[model samples]
Target: MLKIEEIQEIIKLIDKSSINEFIYETNGTSVTVKKSADEYTIQQPAAVTAPPVIQQIEKPAEPVVQEQAPQIAAAEPATSTKKTVDYDYEIVSPMVGTLYHASSPDSDPFVQIGTKVSSNTTVCIVEAMKLFNEIEAEVDGEIVEILAEDGELVEFGQPLFRVKK
Candidate 1:
């Protein structure tokens, strides 16, 4: 079971972060915290036993208007600006750590959009357990987009960049 101060800290972190919900489990205890606009809610089991799994709705409901179907179809091009890339190579993080786009704060980023990189290019750095390890782009290609945020914590095998040969 988590202490009251720990739970409050987690709630504060969730409020500051963009994450909608946080769930933690240990041994047989489980806790879930969700943030909605200005309200914060925390849920936990009464005893020390684990709680049942809960499915959540990830997205909000979109407004549907049958009569405006044609108008919506005509206005799609303006609202939908995202392009779909069918084939691309992803530069993935090799370890779980904090990702840094540059060696230092004022320094230029290692790679950017449209930057051409070889197989041995150092694209970024991941600091794990106080050690900063330079990450390489294993594929030779031009960087199309950066997927991970600079200085954010990244999970192992998380895609950092999208590249096209």
Candidate 2:
């Protein structure tokens, strides 16, 4: 495992370099640092685990006291409550990448709230590595909400939009 001083030195090197991302792995340990516009993200390896320590405590024997059970309120009827309708369809990202709402900054977003979309409708662009992949809405529905923001890094299976089916 890398020491704290070593990790701090690595971070300083990254900040001084022009690289957007840096990754290092060795002996089952891995570290990743990603830098974008104004922020930096770091992914550290899981902590090393040690064997559990066993301990013993002595207590004096005493009479057992019974406690009264707490009462729970009765549940209300489901029909008496108002609930918002949920969307059945969601557009998810296919890979880990940065999401783009439009082809260019000056262009309008492909889909907005209440915008109807079909299987062939191109909803957004996901840039991974150096490739730009256009994501489409596989289900026919109206977009109810965009779960991801433009230029944000998205992970695989992350929901990008909620569509009303």
Candidate 3:
């Protein structure tokens, strides 16, 4: 567990620093951090000619919440309690294609933080062969995480959600 003082220091550093990416590894855990501009565009590595999915080049005013260190400590021994690894469900891609967060360039994303999603919800779009396909959920659960960026090309079975059962 991270100390409160350390968590505060990390938040301060994140606010004061502008190095869009940061990584820290300690105690067998690795944390990767990124702060993108509103456009939230990601650069494709050289030698990879595929275009990036996210094309927004302008900055958006998303609130910044550097981690504050989990308040609750880890669980006790496994025998003390059943592990909560039983996820309610996961949304996975059906094909290898580019994922899009919105229907169009100037439209709102299909989903956002705290968005309640039901089974068959259209969470995002995946474009293949110049055709846009709506990717829907296969199970009912609150979205706990969006594993891929907007316009990211996801492979078959790639994780798209970390849902609470």
Candidate 4:
């Protein structure tokens, strides 16, 4: 809370300054005092950060190549070579967390559509409680569609992939 004298002082400062807006910070208290059109406003921040001294970096996109499709297919989902069976299964997330495609920073992914899988095969990994848990296939199927993006936070019962078993 501010004292009446402090409020009066702020009002006096506003009347004196011709600038459209003003802001000041001290101790743990910071206030953004501003005037827009004919309205006056004040906002106090709960947390503060020291203004950074730096420059921004920009990123450029790599050129797309048609030859990379095969590499991307292999890189994104490395399939298993084994027997097959017929089953209808929906690959749902086991928990509420972020979904990951690859196993490690340098490694390729575990599974993708047209990738042969068994009931014990790990299709993807989900992160929960700061721990990565392997999501396995309940039944063998070809991944028909991926319903979520990499590093996307998912909820329980979220359809991660639609499988054609």
Clashes of each: 0, 0, 5, 1
Top TM-score: which candidate number? Answer: 1
Query: Please, what are the lDDT tens digits per residue for candidate 3 over residues 1-165?
Result: 344456445435554555454444444444333444321111212233333222212225456655333221222123557344445677888888999989998999888755788887899998888888898876677777778998786888898876775
- The lDDT of model 4 is 0.65
lDDT of each: 0.75, 0.74, 0.62, 0.65
Task: Report the C-alpha displacement of residue 82, candidate 4, in angstroms.
Answer: 31
Please write out the lDDT profile of model 1 over residues 1-165, one tens digit for every residue.
567668767766655555667777776666777656445556655445655454333434433233211111111224567787643699999999999999999999999988999999999999999999999998899999898999897999999998898
* Model 4: CA > 4 A from native: 1-87
Candidate with best lDDT: 1
Q: Estimate candidate 2's RMSD in Å.
A: 17.6
Which residue pairs in candidate 4 collide?
87-165
State the lDDT at 87 in candidate 3.
58
lDDT by residue for model 2 (1-165), tens: 556567566656655555556766655556565544445555655642433322222223433254322221222123546455489988999999999999999999999998999999999999999899999999999998888999998999999999997
User: In candidate 1, how many Å is residue 9 off?
Assistant: 20
* Model 1: residues with Cα > 4 Å off, grouped in runs: 1-81
| lDDT of model 2, residue 82 | 43
lDDT by residue for model 4 over 29-57, one digit each (tens)? 56555543344566667656755222222
TM-score of each: 0.54, 0.51, 0.48, 0.47
**Quick one: how many clashes does candidate 4 have?**
1
Q: Which candidate, 1 or 2, would have the higher lDDT against the true structure?
A: 1
Colliding residue pairs in candidate 2: none
Instruction: Tell me how far the alpha carbon of residue 7 in candidate 1 is from the true structure, in angstroms, after superposition.
Output: 14
